[model samples]
Every structure is written in C-alpha cells, then in structure tokens.
Target: MQPLLIYNTLSHQKELFKPLTPDHVGMYVCGPTVYGDGHLGHARPAITFDVVFRYLRHIGYKVRYVRNITDVGHLEHDADEGEDKIAKKARLEQLEPMEVAQYYTNRYHAAMDALNVLRPSIEPHASGHILEQIELVQKIIDAGYAYVSNGSVYFDVRKYQEDTKKYGCLSGRVIDEMLSTTRELDGQEEKHFSGDFALWKKAAPEHIMRWNSPWSVGFPGWHTECTAMGTKYLGETFDIHGGGMDLMFPHHESEIAQQTAVCGHGPCKYWMHNNMITINGQKMGKSLGNFITLDEFFTGKHELLDQAYTPMTIRFFILQAHYRSTVDFSNEALIAAEKGYARLMQAYKTLGRLQPSKTSSVDVKEYRQKCYDAMNDDFNTPIVISHLFDMAKVINTVNDKKATLTQADIDELKGVMDTFVFEIMGLRDEASSDNTALIDGLMKMILDIRATAKANKDWATSDKIRDELGTLGVTVKDGKDGATYEL
Candidate 1:
C-alpha cells in the first residue's frame, strides 16, 4: 500500500491520513435530505465519497462508513420563520411528511444504485434519532454554550466563540461579520443575536414533523441531528467527514460548532468537500432554476440534453475530472465520455485476446505503480484515468502486433487493469447492466441462426440476416473461430 494523503478542509492543506486506530478507519458523509428527486448536485458528492470508501477498503483498512439520511430538520430558509423542507413539500401535496420522506428516500436509493455507488455501512435516519439529538442538546446546554429562548434551545454563537475562539475557523468567516450579514427577521425575537442558530426549534401549530424535546414540542435543528448521529456512530472524534462544497458554509460550519461545544473539540480529523456541478459555467442549483434531475438526464427529457446518457457515461464523466473540481455538464462532453468509455471497455476485452510473443515491449509493473501513485495523491482520479488510457494504448499496440508481450507480462497487465478499472474505480460495462439476460439470450439465438445459415452454404440467407440486423443498429462480424455482434 502507498501513503494516502487527503486534502483536509479544516487546515486548508493536503495532509497524510493517520487514523486513530491502526488499520481501522471511520468515515461519515452527509446524505440527501429526501424531500424531492435527486439532482446532479446530489450525485457529485455521493459518487465522490463512494470512491473514497472504495479506495480506503482497497488499501487494506477496516472502515466503518456512516452516511446519514436527513428525513427531517432541514429548513427551506436559514431564518427562524422557515418551514421544514419535508413538511412544506408534504403540505403542498396533501401527503404525510413521512410519506414524502420515504418516497424520495427510495428514489434517491434507486438513483444511487444506477450510479453503482456502494451503500454506507450505517445509514441512520434523523427522524429515528430524536433521543440522541435531545441528549446532544442537553450536552450543549450543560456546557454553557446554548440557551433556551422562549420554548426553543439556541446555540449561543458569540458565547461559544468566547469560550473556544475556534468559531468560524473552518469557514474563515469573522464572527462579527456574520452577525452583521445574517438577517434580522420578524420571528427571531427570542434570539439574543442574529447569528445564533437553533439547536431545537419550537414547532408551529400546523407543523407536521414535531418531536417532544425537553424544551418544547418541536423538531431538531437542521445542524444538530448530524452532530448527534455522528457522535453516536463514529464516536466523538473520527477520521473523515465529507459533503459537497456548498455545505462548507453555514450547514457544516454550524455542525462543527455544535460538536465542538459538546465534545470539547472538532468532530472529524479530515473534512473533505467535493465541488459542485455547473451548467455552462454557472452553478446548477434548484433555487437558480437550472437544476436537472437524474431521471431527466436518463430519459433525455430536459431541454438541455441532446440525447439520453447511460449510467456508465455519467459515472465516467464525473470520474474524468478531479473530485475537487467543478464538473460542467454538456452534451458534447457526455458524448465524448460515452465514446471514451466504449474504447476503454473494448481495450479491456482486447487485452484478454492479445497473444503473447517470445519477448515483451511494455513494462506493465511501472504502469501499476503509477496507478497507485495517482490514487494515493489526494485520490486524483483524473490522473488514474489518464494512466488507464495509457494502458489501453499498450493493449491496442500489442493486439495489432505493433508491440509484443510475454505470457507473464500479459497476465500482469490483466490483473493491473482489473484492479484499477473495476475494483478501485468501480466502473462497469453499460451493456452488462442494461437488460443483460434478455440481450445475451437474444444475441445467442440470433448468432446461432446465422451460424446455421453459414454452415448450409446459404449465402443469401446468411447475408440477409446480417444485413437486416445491421439495419436495426447491430453489427455482426465473422472471423476464423466464430461470429460476434454488438449493439
């Protein structure tokens, strides 16, 4: 294993990862809010951390990965007058709040499944962890970092800063500046300062997702649930906490404040944030009305999409760029990714058939080390992908007799490509997942009929079958051993 250095957002530098327990790691990533369909913004962080999870396991570490489902406590606005996102959506739809949560949670899971992201070890939901959240709020109050305003408990941002001087250390915002910039609203009369955030929000009479806390009948604050559930599962101090770059501010900053108040320190050692997805160089977000859902991209239903893109193409498009870079979505980029993915898979198939010669032309061992080096340096996936393309070029050269490889080298090349392409990167062939059994059976039947026609010397029948299948977008090729077709 190579030394893995991850970019830590707290220190604003890349540092060598040193887990508290030797050969063991703990990670927690912020999951979806589950109030609506997942958009491209949701996919970026999911896939980014999925790569981190995969590569951590590959490096021979025992990992406890916990990504939480936020079913409640996320407000549409940052102010006190804001409504719960789930409750607001449910109120408009005339459905139960939990029903809305469950429906979108299933949809989110399905979309993640299509992207081939691995499930986290523990996906604790916010609704089911009210007791934990209540206990955490009590901890903050006991620490003298929070206060009860009317019926709700608020985290005293100014007082916490006075105690630790660590407030705004992660986000680099001056506490005084934040106080001036935050809104002064109609419903914030209980708060002593405009920047103070609710640890427990008193529920409105019509609020659907109310819980019984010591303070009042209300719901947990948007930022408190993560702190409670995170410490509950990954301990007070853990290895990594990951989310989108958009969350680097207020949300994660608030999370850090709550956790530090309770535990006497920041929660996680390494904070990783993946950059957002942009459209035409502008940020793609729901508020901007430029967001495109995953289903819309899959069906090519959005006006911005030129054609329906496959799951693999979407995955490859994301992986082609460094995780920390903002990936812009466009039809030309997606089409190029689809073509590049096809070429890489074809080379993978070709490597299996490349005949070994008496001598070798390429040193696959060096390429294997380079692949590891790419991933080791902050999980730079674009560099690893570039290395994969270089290997593909070697495979093509050997297959075309422009280069030669010994049997041992050929076997090593296969192992290296398999480990990097399939295991570490977690990419799969698109054809294998789309109606696999039916397509395989249909192709087998069609090829068998073509073979029978050729065996009988029925040129007319064989050529017609081949020509008609071509008209339907299937290409058939004959060789010495047999025939193969691809769609």
Candidate 2:
C-alpha cells in the first residue's frame, strides 16, 4: 500500500522513488573489478542490487540495470600509482592481462549465477570501451576540469571545486580539509594537489596493458570508466546508481564530479549504497587475510567453516538483515540460518499437500500487504522473512488440524509464499524434492520392506532397517497416519 522509499546516499535520507520516466527506470550499479576469485565480500552488492532489480521489475517498471565490469584500469592499492590489479596478477601467474581478466570474470559470473543473481541488462567492460573513456577524458579537459601533466591526465579538483561545490556533497568531504590531511598521491609532482585523481595514467615501459590515449600510452584511470560507461549506457542522468558503501567516497564521489563537470548535472536521481559484510566484528577483505571466498563457503574448504553451506542458505543469511545494515558472518549464525531456511522451504512444499477445510482460520490476505510493506520500507527483507515464517507456522497449524484453511485461502497463501519467498526475496528451493526423487523412490521401497517386516511380526528385520538408517542420520517417524522418513 505504500510507495518504495530508497535511502539516497547523496541526500543522506530516505525519499520516495519516483522514476524520471513514467514507465521506465534506468539504474547503474558499480560491479566487480574481477581481478581475483569472487569472495563473500563480493556477494553482498551483487545480491543487494539484484533484489533491487527484481523488486523494481515486480512493481511493473521496465528496468534497464547497467552493471559494469572493470576488466581493466583498476590499480592494486586503490591508488593511481600501483600496477593494475589484473595486470599484477597476470605478471605473477605469467599470463596475459586479458587472460587473467577473462579467467576471473568467468569465475565471478559462475559465483553470481550460483547465487541466483540475475544478469544485468548491460554488463559493459572497461577494456571494451576505451574510446568512450578517452572521449570523456577529452571532454573534461576541454571543460577545464582536468589538465595534462607529464603525459598523464589528472582531474583539477581545486579548480573544479571553485566552479561547483559538488565534489564534497556525496562524501561529506571539505576540499580544503582534504588538501590539508590528504596523503601523498602517486604523481605528486604532476598533480596540483594531493587530492587530485588520475583520469588517465601514463604507463611505464614495463606495463603490458597500455593503450594509446590522448595523454600517453596508458590505460584509463580507475574512476574514468564508470563515468564514461554509465553515461554511455544509462545516459548522463539516470534514475539510480548503486554499489557497496565502500565506494561512497572517492569512487562514487568522483563519479558525481566527473558527471557534473562534463554533463553539467549529477548522474543519477538516487544514490544507493549497500553496507558491508563483516566476519568476527571485522571487515572481510582479501588484504586482511580474513576474507572467505564464496567457493570456500560453498565447499567448506576454509578452516573457519563448520560445514558446507548451499547457495540458498547464504542468500537467506544475507537477506536476513536490512540492506543498509552490516551483516556479520559466523558459523553459529549461518547454521541457524540454514536450519531456518530449511524449515521455511519444507513448509512451502508442505503447503501443496494441505487439504482445505470448509472455513478459513488465518488471514492470508493480510500477509501479502505485510510482506510488501516490509520490502517497501527501504527493502527491509528481515521483516519480510519473519512474515514468511509466520506463514510457515500457519501452514503447520493447518496441517495439524489445529487451524483450518479454505481453498481460496490455500491458493492465497501459496501466492504469498511464492511472491515473498521466490519473487521478491530472490530465493529458490536449493534442495528441490525432485532432485532426490530417485533416492526418495529407493527409500520408499526400503521403508515398504520394513513395513512388511513389521506386518509379519519380524522385529529383527524392522530393527535392522531402523538401526541402519539411524546410523546414516536418516530419521524415520512412525505414526497412525502414515510412516515417513528423511535424510
């Protein structure tokens, strides 16, 4: 019943989401650099923006979500001085830079696909758009917002600050304060100020990924590709721009300045940032050596893991918190999430087998609104998940004959589950019942043999079957209704 309210990183407040166009929405999310294997840190933004993409479409907006892949021009230390992350990796592995990029990009895509993150409408690669980046660099130069120094192009932050006081707005940074406290940049002699950032970096002779640009034989700056590619795909001004909260300053901030400097206005109507994921109250990152890769989580290869977690369990764990809130990782927390997810999923399957009563006992209609309300409240997925659990309880009560459901209520409940569980939450049944069909059929025949044993008063054979299954952690429940088993 309420409109979606998005927290704008620009304004630092929650505002109603009104698309620029009546029926279409354009959104740009900063994607992976793909210099290494995808980690749990990488899963957050992909899943976060993925829910946004899905929810927008579910609400009937024709959405074009452009998420760019930084296949080139990303430095090792998040600074202009260091070698490209991909290039550095390539050097260590004795491979071409493009080869390294392609390998990791494939790995990233596979990880994302496992997480059920829908592919964006346009996934532009920086290496594929060197011309557009160069053109944008030249535009900034002509606009007097950038200057050529020592064969490299640097943004004139001091000069640009004088024209428009827009640089510090997104990051809440003061230009003078930044200059006073800023650390030494890579090309200190060439830059007018320490705060100045590279638009294009002049490559050294040893560098292998150099391209001929107006400035020098070099690659585009780390920040240049987003401005160029975002504008190229999503237009100079679009509806929303999103990424991790880590990109707020410098990355997203520079994006604003570049877009405003060249295009004369801000890039997007809303700036959304999802918060980080932490491990043991500390940030998870490759540099920190505390980070766990998604592969490690799925395979339980890391020493910190208790057991392997399915992709859906990981998804449920992330969505258990609000997007703006930081999610902490722990084996205990994850185990609880896994069990909770399994319970909810099992209830969903049970919903199909329920026999409707003559009268309805639960308010299924109210659930749809509550789930939507939770999601509409800045995409508060935790509350939506709680409501789903409530539905699960209802399903259990109905099955127990403690409550009742009409046929219409049954269908409505199923709709609510499908919408909140599958559609909005972007969750799928990870362990499909059909996936274990053959095993289920085998188990059924075995249990039928045990049943025959019981009918024949063969206590030894029944006990043998039960004890053998118990050793394998398979649980068999006997009741007057029927016999059931699970593994």
Candidate 3:
C-alpha cells in the first residue's frame, strides 16, 4: 500500500506522515462552541477530520483524538465588547449557562452521530478546566510574556515578538501588517501593542460567567483554552492539530504563541486545515448570513434546497469533493451526488448476490490496488469513490452475465467493497438500518404468493396482491429472480 501523505498547513506543503511515537498518533481538533445549533459550517470540519481519524486508524496507527467543546471562553465577536456566547443564550432562554451548553452539545452530538462521525477519544470542555487555564495565564505572566492591566490580563505581543523571532509564522502576517489591517478597538489604551489580545478580560457588573483568577474575575481568552486542553491531553507536542482554514489566523496563530510561551515549543508537529464549504461561490460563515443549519439541510427546509437530502446523501456529497477544495452547494450538484451515491450503493448490494464463475475475465486484484493507491494519497476520497464506481461497472457486468468472476475474484471484490465502501469511507447501508429486514421479509413472502398466482394465470389475485401491497408502502416487482419487493 502507498504511504499516506497529508498537507501540512504549518509547512504549506504535503508531507509524508510519520507519527511522533512509532505506531501511535495524537490529533487535536477545535470543536464547536455550543452556543447554538450546529450549522452546515460545522459539518465540514467534523466530517473532514473524521475521515482523517478513520484513515489513520485504518492504517494500523493507535490514534488518540482530542476534540474539545468550548463551553466557555468564546466571545460573541472578535472584539472583546460582546457578551459570552453561551451566557447570552442562557439569559435569553432563562436557563443556566451549563444548561445551555448541555442542550447544544447534545444537539451537536446528535447531528454528528447522524452523519456517522465517530466521537473523539477525549472531549474536554473549557469551563471544566478553569484551574488549568488560570495556571497557564500565570505562567505566561511569570515568564514576562504577558502583563495584567487593571483587572484584565493581556498577552504583550511586542515583548513576545522581541523574545521570539517567528511570532507570526502560522498566519504569515507581520506585526506591522496586522496593525495596518486590524480595525482599532475603542478601549485599546490598556494593551501595550496594537495586536496584543486578552489573556483574560475583567468581567463587567452584569457578566454572567465569571471565574476568579490571578488577574480578576474574568474568563480565559478564546485561544488559551485550546492550548491548555491540548497540552493537558496530548502533551507539549503531538502529531496533528486540525481545524477550518478560517481559524489559521488569530485562533491557531495565538495558540502557537501561547503554547510556545509556556512550554518553549509549539504544540503540534503537523497542522491540517480543511477548506470552507461555499454556497453560491461565497464562503458559508455565521457572520456572512449565508449559513444554513444542519437541521435545515436534513429537512430540506432551506429556501435554497430543492428537496430534503438524507444524511448519507450529504456525507456522500461532501466526500465527492476533495477536502482541500471549496465545494459549492447547489441543487444540481447535490442531485448529481445523490444519483451517483445511489448507483454506487446499489452496485455494492448487487455484489453480494452475483453468482461466481469458474473463470475470471477481469483483473480484480489490480483494481483493488488502484483503490488503495487513491486513498493513500492524502485520503483522496473522491478519486477512491470514482474508482469504486468503475469497479461497480465490473460487478454489474458480471451480474448481467456479460462477464465472469471466479470464487477467489468474488472474495477479493467483497473485501475491496467492505474495506473502502464501509470501513474506510465510513458509510453504512442507511436503507438497511430502519425496519428493512422485516419489511423485506414480509415483501418476499407476499411476492412468493403473487408469483404462484401469476404461475396459475390467476390475473385477478396477482394484480390484487400487487396493487394492495403497493398501497401499503411496498412495491412488488416481477423479475428474473422470481419477484422482488421494496418500499
């Protein structure tokens, strides 16, 4: 099998993967803030890194994946002037902050589960690790990289830059460029430098979620939580850290600064960033107002969607595009993906029922190797899926008696489908999961009776069974293999 090569955002190039420990891999991904329902924007990262997690494990690596829930420390906006996202939601709903967090967190998990995303090994919450965050802030201050002004603590970017040479390495922005691009904040006198961000902000009189720290009763900075949580779980340096490409600046950059300030080294060996999902050629973001929620997509309740798309359809649609590419959402694109996914899945089901021949006519082993080659190259799921469709053509040919497959060839084909279609792609038979067995069994029995009626030239009884069964959410069809029924 070809070795896996992943694009590293830090190096700005695709590099061959080699775990820090021999066969062990550690990955950290920034998860949701739990302030509201998960939107389509949230699904990209969840599914993108989910593939990474699955593929790593598939390659015989013992992987430890840490994705955190930001129950605290996420300000409503980039500016420090807004209310806490969770706290504001709590007040509006007349619930505690934790209550709001729990509700949204469960909602997020349900959405992910529906998408078939595996839960992370450790899902640390920022609110639950106050002491660790406080200690980190203290370490930064003690190291002279941060200072407390009034009751708030801010990272001294000037001092940090003077001490550390590659301050803006991840963002590729110079301090002067940031100073020029960033809009001036109203209350900026406390910060020593224009780019310096809050390590802790002093809580207002009506602030809902405040915690006692060395500086004052304030919450941790947005970037500090990931650093503390990541280091706590994955150690000072781990294998990979992944998030949306939008987080490269400020969020991931600040994480690099904070981790280096305390631990004297960067947190992760590789940084992977998945590109955004676009709608109408524009990036789908919360601030853009073009964002659609996952619920809206699943229900087809959005104005832009033509019809409801099943969870598997959405997953297949996403996998159709390379994760690094910006996939534009449209009815046409989704329809195409839906039909393509159905074709592949139908062919997969047909593979099991195909009769084996004494002689093989195709090179099944070579085709299987090609599938692995596609996946090994940066987990190119789209290319791998395309190859699966090609194999599907072969399977269909064999099933139609236009070609042939030996017993060994049939076993190889089954193994290929099982590995790539189910194991690596993480797709399950969605139609088979919901009362399909019982429905299929009952339909088969009914179809048998209908076949006997047809054999006896009893047109009335056969048509009655077919028409009644069709009315009751089942369709019976007469085929070469007797009759088959479906709902």
Candidate 4:
C-alpha cells in the first residue's frame, strides 16, 4: 500500500505524512462560530476531516482531534464596526448569548450525527477560555509584536513581517498585495497598517459579552481564540491543522503569525483545507445568501429543493467527489446520488447471505489492496466507492451462482467492506433497526401466504401481496432462487 500523502497548504504540494511523534498525532480543525444553524458549507470540513481522523486511527496512530466552537469574537462580514454575530442574533431573538450558542450547537451536532460523522475527541469552546486568550495576547505584547491603543490591543503586522520576512505564505498573499487589495474599513484608525489585525477589541458600552482584561473591558479578536485554544489543547506544534479553504487567508494566516511571534516557530507540521461546496459555480457562503442550511435540506424547506434527502444520501453525495474539488449541488445530482447509495447499500446487505464455495473465483486480496491504495492517495473516497461498486458486481454474480468464493475470500471481502464502508468512509446502514426480528417475522408470514398463492397458480393474490408491501415501504424482489424483502 502507498503511504498516506496529504496536500499541505504550507508547502503547496502533496507530501508524505510523517508524524512528529511515532505513535501519536494531533489535529486541529477550525469549527463552527455557532451564531446560526449550520449550513451545507459547514458539513464539508466536518465530514472531510472526520475521514482523516478515522483513517489515521485505522492505520495505527493514536489521534487527538480538537475542533473548537466559536461562541464569541465573530464580527459581521462587511462591518467590523458592527455587533458580535451571536450577540446580534440574541438581541433579535430575545435570548442570552450562551442560550443562542447552546441551541444552535445542539442543532449542529444533531445534523452531523445524522450524517454519521464521528464526534471530535476534544471540542473546546471559545467562551470557556477567556483567560487563555488574554494570556496569549499578553505574550504577543511582551514579545513586542503587539501594542495597545486606548485599552485595545492590535497585532503589529509591520513588525511581525520585518521579523519573520514571510507573513502571508499560507494565503499566497504578498504584503504589497494585501495593502492594495484590502478595502479600507471605518474604525481602523487605531491600526498602523491596512494588514494589521486586532488581537483584542475594546467593547462598546452596549456590548453584552465583554470581559475585563489588561487591555480593557473587551472581547478577544476573531483569530486570537483559535491560536490560544489550539495551542492550549494541542501544544505549540502539532501534526495537522485543517479548515475550509476560505480560511486559508486572513484567519489561518493570522493564526500562523500570532503563534510564530510568541513561540518563535510555526504551529503545525501540515496544513489541510477542504474546498467549498458551490452553487452555479460560485462559492456558497453565508454572506452570499446562496447557502441552504442542513435542516432546510433534510426537511425540504428550501425553495430550491425538489424534495428531502436523507442524511446518508448527503454523505454519499459528498464522498462521490474528491475533497479538494468543489462539489456543486443540484436536485438532479442529489437524486442520482440517492439512487446510487441505495444500490451500494443493498449490495452490502446481500454480501452477508452469500454462500461460500471450496474454490475461489475472485482475487479478493488484490481488491483489498486497491481500496487501501485509493484512501492512502490523499483520502480519495470517490475512487474507493468505485472499487466498492466493482465488489458489488462480483457479490451479485456470486449470489446468482455464476461465480464462487472460498471461506477465506469471503472473510477478507467482508472485512474490506466493513473497513471502507463503516470505518473509513464513515457511512452507516441507516435503514437498519433493532426491530429486525419483528419485521422479519411479519415478512416471512406474508411471504408464506404468497408462496401458497403461487403454488396454487393464483397470480392475483401473489401480486396483491407484493404490491401492498411495496406501498408500505418494503420492497419484495422475486428471483428463481427465492424471494427477498427489504425495508
């Protein structure tokens, strides 16, 4: 099998993964801001990195995955002068700031859990770590990389650029380019340069989430919490730092500068970014008003959707494409994915019932190696699914007695399916239930009646039983070997 090769944003190339420690790996992903319900945009990184977390553990690494929840310090997209995002939402809804965060955080987890995403090992909240944020700001100030103005602290971009010589490497941005491209904002008189960002913002009297710090009664900057919380949990240097590609600039770039200025070294060994989900070839962002919330998609509440899609269908749609490629959403595409997902899942169910023969007809070992190779190649899930489809074809042929499988081959095939489908891909058989015994007994009784009808050449009775069961959400398929039913 090929060694895992992940595309590193810092190096701008796909490099072989070598952990800093032999058996341990630390990964930090920038998580939700919790100001609103999670949209389709949020699912990308959660599902993408969940696979990374799963694969790393599957390959024998003890992984620590830290995904933070940002309950504070986010500003409106256009107006840095505007109110905190969560605070603004709370005022509109007449609720406390923490109340808003808790409500949406619960909703976000429910959506992700429905999609079968693995929960992160450590999910830290920004509001819970104000002291650590203040200490980090003080460290930057003590290092002469930040200065105070009217009880507010701002990182000195010019000073850090002069000291480090490369400030915007992750964003592929030059200092001159930022000075030229960045729009002038209203309350930036305190900043010495256009590229300088806030380490702490002095809160207005009306601000409800203010905390007292050495700077003033203020809130930490949007970028400061990630640097502080990430370092606090994962140490100064870790294995992989991941987020959406949109965060590659400004947010992640600022994070690198802050960490480097304080620790005299960069934060992580590898940087990974998942590409955006698009609509009509444009990025789907909250500010753009083009995004559909996960709830909206599942409930068919969006004007653009034709009908609701199950969580497994959404997961299958995402895994059908490479993580690095932008996946465009459409009703047609979703319908296709839904059908394809059902076919694969049905085959997975059929594999268990196949009888083993003395002689093997399929090369199961080679097929298993291909599955591993696809995953090792930058976690290529699309290709892995293609391999699964091939396996499905073989399983179907063998079920028809056109092919054969030895006992060892049967065991290896089952292991491969379980690893790729359940463990690495993070997909579940959503149709499964604990009431299988009851459902199976009922279906058997109905099938017995149908068998009697068929034996008596009463086609009308047999067809009625099949049609009625189909309307009740159970599919009955008849073949020469036997009749099977699935719900």
Over the stretch 1-487, how does candidate 3's per-residue lDDT look in tens digits?
Answer: 7788888888888889998999999999999989889987788889989988988898799999999999984853447455777777788889999988998999999889989999999999999988998989999998889999878888888888888876788878889988898777754787788788888888877678999987788888888899999999999999999998888888898899998888888899899888888887887776777778888888998887889887788888888888888888888888888898888888888988989889999888887788778877877899999889889999999999999999899889889988888888878778778786786677778788888899999999999998998888577777787887765
Q: After superposition, how far is residue 306 of candidate 3 from its true place, in Å?
A: 1.1
lDDT of each: 0.89, 0.88, 0.86, 0.89
The Cα error of candidate 3 at residue 476, in Å, is 32
**Model 4: lDDT of residue 184:** 78
* TM-scores of all candidate predictions against the true structure: 0.89, 0.88, 0.88, 0.88
Q: Which 10 successive residues of model 3 have the least lDDT summed?
A: 73-82
- Report the Cα lDDT for residue 255, model 2: 88
lDDT by residue (303-349, candidate 2, tens digit) is: 77889988889999999989899999999999999999999999999
Candidate 2's displacement at residue 418, Å, is 0.9
For candidate 1, the per-residue lDDT at 130 reads 94
Q: How many clashes show up per model?
A: 0, 0, 0, 0
> What lDDT tens digits, residue by residue, belong to model 4 across residues 413-477?
88998999999998888778447788899899999899999999999999999999998868998
The lDDT, on a scale of 0 to 1, for candidate 2 is 0.88
Give me the displacement of residue 428 in model 1, in angstroms.
Answer: 0.5
The predicted structure with the larger TM-score, 2 or 4, is 2
lDDT of 1 by residue, 1-487 (tens): 5789999999999999999889999999999999989988888899899999999999889999999999984763565356777888899999999999999999999889988899999999999999999999999999999999889998999998888898888889888898778777755788888888888888988788998988999998888878898899999999999999888778889889998898788889999999988887788876777788998888898888889988778989999999999899889999999999999999899989999999897777788899999999999999999998998999999998999999998888889888888888889987755697898799889889989998999989899999999998799989888999887
